[model samples]
Target: MNTIEPRSTPQPHLTLAQADHQDTLRNCVRRSLNEYFRNLEGEAPNDLYPMVLAEMEIPLLEKVLEYTRGNQTKAAEMLGLNRGTLRKKLKQYGLL
Candidate 1:
């Protein structure tokens, strides 16, 4: 007879180094935003969301693709993107 075992729940833990890294990321984003507005110098910024997303997305997709060695399945898993979404982004960025 086959038997099934109950699964244990996962315990989440945050280390001090992880907390520091989160703070560092927050600080970097804050600094970048400040610089962006400063550079505007009274000019209004347009399409900030799309602009930032595209800028960040391209490099992220490139790195993830490289890291996975063009394995879409693993890359999608690492990126928390569905396979279809990952494929779409890869195609959009012309990496596919």
Candidate 2:
């Protein structure tokens, strides 16, 4: 006959401590952002993503046009696009 010791159950205090720590981190970030913005003394923040995309598209279209030497049909072909579709995108993006 052999006797085995029973394993002890895990405690919940560790899980609660982790949750509290995460809450503290969130509050710290919120407070820091508030303080930083309150001390701002400059121009307003801009939507950088859209602005960058617009700036990039202009040069990209120009380069594609140059590569095709101003030939819309060949440009569309080389770009693997339908000519009319490319024309529409160009017009929509104000590049036409």
Candidate 3:
């Protein structure tokens, strides 16, 4: 007969040094994204914020809905939003 070994529970611990390192990493990523956006704005002739956000959100929402097999409830749960809100966004983006 084969027996399975018991697995130990994992401990959750965050030391001060680890926390500081995480904060530094977060700041670096924020700085890098900000710089990238600034460069994009400089290169583009028109204001690109809304256009960029809409373009990004459309494919992202479609992929998420597809991953949930076109079920809005599951997609909303995965997105941490209410079903109504997800439906509204889908309609607004003409994906519904």
Candidate 4:
């Protein structure tokens, strides 16, 4: 007879340095936003969401593609994105 065993939950294996780096990245975004708000000089912000997403997405895709040596499948896997979705983003960002 064959028996199946229950699976245990997987744990993330982030190191202290990685955690610190994550915090640093958050702080950098916070600082950049604060600077942007300051520079607005009483003008209202417009389309901030898409602006930030585009700014972040371009470099993220570029670096990941570079890291994977332009392999979309591996890059999508690393990004937890569907390959087609990654291709759409690549095309949207004019990287395709």
Q: In candidate 1, what are the lDDT values of residues 1-96, reduced to their tens digit? A: 999876987757878766645657566666678899999989999999988888778888999989989898999999999999999988887878
| Poorest stretch of ten by lDDT in candidate 4 | 18-27
Cα lDDT tens digits for candidate 4, 12-70: 99887666556576767877888999999999999999999998889999999999999
TM-score of each: 0.68, 0.43, 0.53, 0.75
Q: Between which residue pairs do clashes occur in model 2? A: none
49-88 per-residue lDDT for model 3 (tens digits):
6765686678879999999999999999999999999999
Best by lDDT: 4
Q: Local error of candidate 2 at 43, Å? A: 4.5
Model 3 bad stretches (over 4 Å): 1-44
**Which candidate number maximizes TM-score?**
4
Q: Residue 55 in model 2: shift from native, Å?
A: 0.9
Whichever of 3 and 4 has more TM-score, that candidate is: 4
**Per-residue alpha-carbon lDDT of candidate 2 for residues 1-96, written as tens digits (9 for 90 to 100):** 999877987756657546645657455555655665677666565774675566566666778999888899988887788999879868978768
Report lDDT (Cα) of residue 2, candidate 3.
100
Per-prediction CA RMSD (Å): 6.6, 15.8, 6.6, 7.0
TM match of model 3 to true structure: 0.53
> Which has the higher lDDT value, candidate number 1 or candidate number 3?
1
Model 4 TM-score relative to the real fold: 0.75
Cα lDDT, all candidates: 0.85, 0.73, 0.81, 0.91
